[model samples]
Target: MLTERWRETLVDTYGTPPIGLVSGQGATLTDEKGNSYIDLLAGIAVNALGYGNEHVAQAVYHQAQNLVHTSNLFATQPVLDAGAKLIERVGDVNARVFFCNSGAEANEAAFKLARLTGRRRILAAKHGFHGRTMGSLALTGQPDKQNAFRPLPGGVEFYPFGDADYLRQLVELNPEDTAAIIFEPIQGETGVIPAPDGFMQKVNDLCEEYGILLIVDEVQTGVGRTGTFFAHEIEGVRPDVITMAKGLGAGVPIGATITRGRARDLFTPGTHGTTFGGNPVACAAANVVLDTVDAEFLAEVTRKGDYLRQKLENLPNVDHVRGRGLMLGVVLNAPVAKQAVRGGLEKGLILNAPKENVLRLTPPLIISQHELDTALNTLRTILEELA
Candidate 1:
């Protein structure tokens, strides 16, 4: 079986899956056993347009046929278009985009930019996840993920996720030494926790007052996942830097570390580069996703998110819902989220448990109301049985 083969050949970084998914369409997936599932995880919020997207496939196919890669030595039209589109969405003509392969790389670029400011100190949030890469891992405040890889790149200080007063105290401890303040608008890895209300505005104000750069990590919350082009946009706070991935390229791997104002000028040519970053094929796919997830499309996403949240909140075992838009976490009254995942899978649903009591739902941005209703009915049954 494929699972057996995976166990024998592959490293145990990610434990083998119980079953193999053969294919998918829209928000539904088919497993090797010929069973179908309503995909609510959406590849951890990567497939914004859902599976079997003809437009993304065609864009990738045509771009691959013409030019797949040219490294950083040459420019590609798709790369330029993707960057311009991101900047346009950011509404900052001065913002510059640095493309990379995944969310980790994006945060690494942001880390490097902070270092370039000549101040060694950086502030991050506890229980917040950025990525697993070395620099990003250091920025991530979760000790469990960092303990294994001890003695990570230092100079990062972590404050509790939504404690603005503590954050302010940390900044005042040595404001001159602080280069940047980095955080996720919504913390997804630790059960989809969001920053407290007024936090974004506070972060922006601190950065402005202290001459520090504000870096917002939107890797899991961007690309219309939060019913906004960027989650931080809702607070009307424009950070000096924003990093995003996941849904940026549909299923294609693409990460962007975007910078505005002076922060945009930090990397001068040889300072940073990626071989496969912004490849035409990936950029072309991103272009399709960007064009498809416009204002109108995102409005629909908002409506669906509210609908799903209402259903989840009313579930028998559900405690509440956290995060926002399509990037939601259903908090259960019991710590049986792992078991709930198994139940969901057995009942033709693909669910994710980021915490013992939380089920993270980041379905495709294009998932329809009918799909949501069907999935909710199944989920209700699963929760009832568990209860």
Candidate 2:
């Protein structure tokens, strides 16, 4: 009934959601049919702390009671706190944070910053998904998504993802015309494709050599999802600009476009703004999330990620595991990823297929070993059956 109601009321953009989850706790979710499923996707990696998290709920509740929203004209304590924490985590003491509502807005801000550099050309990566907004959409290289919204914002060039040589050639060819190089540390929507070894470092070096700004789109791979505060941390590259969302608020919608060094000075008074970008309620929730997912907590996530990867790698039908930490994708020998999702749902497991043969797993950062093992066992069973 709820599904029918959704179909009639909501836009068809997302298609029909297969499961109508009524409630959840920790890593387990219960649907309207009263069937419980182990949630391995974590609302597509937004629920870093898992469901029914008391800490996040309490923070949001208290902040809502105190102050819900104030237009950007005024400052809120939670917003200031959230921004400071992010800036500290990124190790960019001078960097400033621009808050928005989702990953698209975060990337949009980064796009605008890139444009302000006075260059007409921008370089991105193929199969690298930024977001759906017009500015972000132009940076995205996936044709299927771009074709529908033809004639997107211009001045964007796409290179192959994880290919340093091609990227360098493109950047060199553009030279003075290029403003910035935007890329994801790990491509999530394109099936959790991680950058090739030293690719990010190369990007950083090239940007420096060419006087171009480097924008790392960490929207899906940041916030402890990749065993670090930011996925690009592993590359040891300090990008001029970084964008993040998803797990930032642990489910309370929040996005951040952070800038370091000269990039911070790009925005003039009337250059940019957002109304509900850093609402006090969302900021409070994000603060709790940031405080909870510290070094110790992230270390545990790394351990669990390694454990899950090892288990999946041993499965008969699994070809390989890609990506890092909790953001993983299983490339199967067969194009049964959709089937696996259906099987998982029927068997009380939550799974996702970002591609025809790729099963993505972006479990909550706070997911326990026991929960991960249980999900793995169910997945192993499903793979065996499919095989």
Candidate 3:
């Protein structure tokens, strides 16, 4: 059904959808043909409180009725309130917020901020994906994506991920030339690989020794996806800049660059801005999302993550499991991830395979135990058949 409609209307970007979803409520989606599915991807980790949540919907409605947009020239109450709440939630008084429309845009703003500090070279990790924008693309270490868009902004170097010694050597060799070191706490696109033990701390020390800004791109892992408000909190390292988007405003399009200490003042009045960056509707939705992902909700996320890991580990053909909190990866014995995803969809489950051998799971933070158990059952049946 999706193929017939998508072939005529939509572009050929994503190929074909497994099913035509009509509506969603909580962690489940309903198709046009009356089929229901357990949504484990959560719109690529964008739905913080799941679909059609009362608080988020109400916040969007009230803000829409009140004030929607006033441009960046004038200050609005909702934007200011959201910014204050972000600072408070992060527990960093010196941090400042720069709003944007998407994860790539947030990374673009952070890249500009790093450049403004009089540093030229940017150091990123291998297989790390920042964004598709020109500035952010330069920092993306994947060659397959970057080769097509040649003549991109240069002066970026890629180092082995989770290798502190190689990173230290690079920083020491180019201390004065390096501007910032940007990386993801967990490499989501590359199968949810977290930093090795003590590697993040070593990277932080290297950045300090080289006087380079450290930027953590938390677009996919932030906002309770990793059982924390911010994933970097688990490592106990405060980055100079943190870029977030996916789960910030639930389903609304919103992104932000939060800078700490002196890095917060890098941008002046005319340096960087966006027309709809801090719009009232998006900020209002983000405020609701933040309020919903409090201490108790985070505890539930940890509990669910542990349960999901144990269940997935016991499933047939699942060789290993990686990642923390609700963000997890099931490494299969063979490259049957695509087949498993297709099979799960047929069994009324929505999942994603970011890599050939790794199946990614980013269920909504509000997903109930019953819902998770249902998903687990569906996945187990599918994997058994595929194997």
> Residue 61 in model 3: shift from native, Å?
0.7
Residue-by-residue lDDT tens digits, candidate 3, 226-270: 988898888788899999999999999999999886488999989
State the displacement of the C-alpha of residue 354, model 1, in Å, after optimal TM-score superposition. Answer: 0.9
Candidate 1 lands at a TM-score of: 0.99
Give one digit per residue, the lDDT tens place, for model 1 in 287-363. 99989988899899999999899888999899899889999999999999999899988999999999999999999
Better of 2 and 3 by TM-score: 2
TM-score, cand. 2 vs. native = 0.99
The order of the candidates by lDDT, greatest first, is 1, 2, 3
Give me the candidate number with maximum lDDT: 1
TM-score per prediction, in order, is: 0.99, 0.99, 0.98
Q: For every candidate structure, what is the RMSD over all alpha carbons to the true structure, in angstroms?
A: 0.8, 0.9, 1.1
Task: Judge candidate 3 at residue 16 and give its lDDT.
Answer: 75
| Overall lDDT per candidate, in order of appearance | 0.93, 0.91, 0.90
Clashing pairs in 1: none
Worst 10 residues of 1 by lDDT: 261-270
Tens-digit lDDT string for candidate 2 (242-351): 99999999999999999987588998898998999999999999999999988899899899989988989999799999989999999999999999999999899999
- For candidate 3, what is the total of clashing residue pairs? 0
**TM-score order of candidates, top first:** 1, 2, 3
